[model samples]
Target: MVVACCFGMIEVVCVEAKDIQSAGLGPVTLAIDSGSCTGLTGPSGSGKTRLLRCLADLDCHEGDVSLNGASRESFTPPEWRTQVGLLPAESFWWSERVLDHFPYKQKPELDSLDLSPVVFEQPLRQLSSGQRQRLALLRLLANQPKVLLLDEPTANLDQDNIMRVEALIAAYRNQHRCCVIWVTHDRAQLERVADRSLTMANGRLDGDSS
Candidate 1:
């Protein structure tokens, strides 16, 4: 196994998660393979979100990180970010209507996620939090990212919405051979969707559970 040295840290980038801030993420180490789902679960402030950010290269740290055998430094930040998508915990929508947000001139099958194309026309504010979350998810999936970083992705949804999100993620993983790192407190959700699981504490990853 090859390890990358970023700034002075040695680690694998396939799916490394570590704390990058001064507070630190508590010394977590984890490696996930391609085309599978891995979960990060723990109490709030356990560095789960920070770990996600580090993998996305959104945070600065001494640990090494890479993707598909290439160091995160190998690609320009934009390229890395585009291929390694992060669905933030809180997303913004500025349009008066939802349909206005997506500019899909050539209508494609929204079927992958079981989302209704017409729902995009509703006002952003009019949609519930769960609907907004689903919309954000659709937007990310539309990008066809190679790696997915989701932060509390279903925090605002009902059972139906949660299932939809899981299905969409699963579909993406199966079809594109993409990797997923989900940060959630939902144990049940993790068990249902993740192929492997890990817990975060302080600033580090615990033993990987499959």
Candidate 2:
């Protein structure tokens, strides 16, 4: 039941997959906490996205998903979303200027994370792949959610940007004391950030903490 050892301020968290029957995920269970730093490695079509969507209440399912002690169903969609935020594989921007998307006035955190200052002036469509990834993560962090669900966040970035994004995520989690459910196929990325590792095979999550 103890997935990892907790150190400093991180708390222990557990997720039990009772029955993923109708949703096609079957009965699966997994638990993760702080200081594990493991990753989830799986091939395509493994239902990683589906599992994350279910937890975010983006899809309906038969099993129960609780955070702390409250069930996901207990909160309204907006309320639930504010508590549990999901950052998709592809980032979105509505305005031509990159800075138009963010609401915060001062983002010293963005600079500390190694994001380029030019990113604020350039159009979203004109940015390179690494820029987009950092922008997406910045937007998500600005929301200050209690839980974060990330899907391949750094897949398109270079080594420098990848490390920056990893450090940013770790800083956000530590500062906010948030629970992160990251879905990634990159073993190195997982080792760099995750506190625990899990794999999805045939619609079930098995605890593979190594």
Candidate 3:
């Protein structure tokens, strides 16, 4: 079910996009509920990433995207981003050390990624790609965004780490009632993690398939 809030007889949406379009991509629209993970699947170049970019305010596009009953325009870019965070396939690093990139020195969540407290002081170049990917997620989570736009967040992870990442996300979603739009190619992963699934093709969302 698309997660929603009810007040007597009225239902309020979490994330709602209306005719959102970017360049050669969608004129797409959809609403996702709080606490639901919606799997988005499509061929490469189908505009999955671009759509996410629009929602995150990282790309300029027509149509409006709103969250938690407010429009994106209601907040400044940084504030909007903090509320609707996007975790891209490749993370951008601005600091030399792992700890420098984070707001806190000791993130307990690192243990779930098989990382230890000592890792915080290590330079970025010393970490593996998988480690960087996992840490990027933790960095994003620190903001506690009300919405999560994940673009293959665990693509670089091994089987064990993939499971760990999935569990971590699920727990966070349930605990916070956050909405998730997860883009992935793995159909099995969708089944395991998504409460609803949508297929995107030729620059638009086809329909709900899950």
Best by TM-score: 3
Q: Please state every model's RMSD to the true fold in angstroms.
A: 6.0, 2.9, 2.4
At residue 107, candidate 2 shows an lDDT of 49
- Each prediction's Cα lDDT score? 0.75, 0.70, 0.87
Q: Give per-residue CA lDDT, model 1, range 111-202, as digits (tens).
A: 65456766656667877777678778877776778899999998988777778778878988878878898888888888898878888777
| Tens digits of lDDT, candidate 3, 20-62 | 9888678898998877889999999888999999999998899
Query: Which candidate has the top score in lDDT?
Result: 3
Q: Candidate 2, after superposition: displacement of residue 87 in Å?
A: 1.5
The TM-score, computed over Cα atoms with residue i paired to residue i, of candidate 3 is: 0.93
Give the clashing residue pairs of candidate 1, or none.
13-66, 25-203, 26-202, 26-203, 26-204, 27-203, 27-204, 28-204, 28-205, 99-120
User: Would you give me the overall lDDT of model 2?
Assistant: 0.70
Candidate closer to the true structure by lDDT (higher is better), 2 or 3? 3
How displaced is residue 149 in candidate 1, in Å?
0.9
lDDT of 2 by residue, 70-98 (tens): 66667888877777778888888777876
TM-score of each: 0.82, 0.83, 0.93
RMSD of 3: 2.4
